[model samples]
Target chain A: AQSVTQPDIHITVSEGASLELRCNYSYGATPYLFWYVQSPGQGLQLLLKYFSGDTLVQGIKGFEAEFKRSQSSFNLRKPSVHWSDAAEYFCALPSGAGSYQLTFGKGTKLSVIP
Target chain B: EAGVTQFPSHSVIEKGQTVTLRCDPISGHDNLYWYRRVMGKEIKFLLHFVKESKQDESGMPNNRFLAERTGGTYSTLKVQPAELEDSGVYFCASSPLPSGLAGVLSSYEQYFGPGTRLTVT
Candidate 1:
């Protein structure tokens, strides 16, 4: 089975400070990883994804993620955190089969402090 | 280009009632999907439709849940005798074409809908 785990349930960062949210996944084979964001009462937005090629992938809103196969991790990072960046972030790995459905993490709630 | 759209942004239904959710995928897109997230849980897959036919429905919880894609343009998911556990946000996504190993090996982005939030009391 494939599963995603975000170790941190909640993270609070000061505005403009660098941010890093850790994500670890367990899968039978190489996985198609993705990072998505959801604001309060909003749908999940695609932030970034890592299918193949580059271990380091950049996404919208000044976000990026790096896939480390050896470590089984794909951590999301932002150089500078903004107040607007305060939202729940999810790490997902879609099954590599007929269905394109994603198995998501419990999500890590990010809180930006002024 | 219009993105995937879902109706009934929020619905409040008593337990044991029936509820229906609708989704209109982007035009020219032939792949449609349904997923949901329960309270404080990860979003789980419900089903997939390639056109008017279902591609896979392995994730559907039980027989009480029904999904349909008519004319391959819009899709509907109905839950009869809704249970409290069914309360969550339902999301729909679409792709320009049927995803195969070629597309999967190339790109892995799937556009998502705004989602419908259902509350069962």
Candidate 2:
């Protein structure tokens, strides 16, 4: 079965500092990759996705992710972090037929310190 | 267009009681999905519905959890004799397949709703 691995469980970054959330996946072929953010008491919102072409994909809220097939990674990056960016980040991969069901990672909790 | 919407944003019920959660997917979406995050565990898939049919229900934990989409419009997941471990957030998602573009495997983004949090005490 396909799975997602988020190495960082908790990360505290100073405000305005760069942020990178690592995500590694285990799959036979390069399945659909996605990044989602869940704010406290909020739903999971899509940050970005990589389907095909363009190794680097840009998403909402000034977030971007690079799909590196060689590394089997799709690490999310932001040049500068904001207080609003403090939330739980999840890396997910398509699991079911035609890639419908999503297999999510354990998730990484981000804390922005001022 | 409205995103996915779930009823009873939060529900607290005693153990061995029954709880039914409803989900209304985005308008015109043919694919609806149910997922849950149990306590400290990662989100797990519960089931998938294509129209009124169950395409994949392999992830359903047990028979106590029943999900139905009678009209293929709204869906309900009922838990009979809820257990303590059933406490978590239940999420509903939906995706649409535009007309004249049938059988195409494009667009896999599933819009989520503000999950329904359940607490079995």
Candidate 2 lDDT (Cα, 0 to 1): 0.92
Q: lDDT at B16 for candidate 1?
A: 94
Strongest candidate by lDDT = 2
Q: List the residue pairs that clash in candidate 1.
A: none
Worst 10 residues of 2 chain A by lDDT: A93-102
Which candidate wins on DockQ? 2
Interface RMSD values for all candidates:
1.7, 1.3
lDDT of 2 by residue, A1-114 (tens): 788999999999999999999999998897789999999988999999898789999999999999999999999999999999999999998994476889999999999999
Q: What local lDDT does model 2 show for residue A47?
A: 95
User: What tens digits encode model 2's per-residue C-alpha lDDT throughout B1-121?
Assistant: 8889999999999999999999999988889999999988899999999989998999899998999999999899999989999999999998876455543444478889989999999
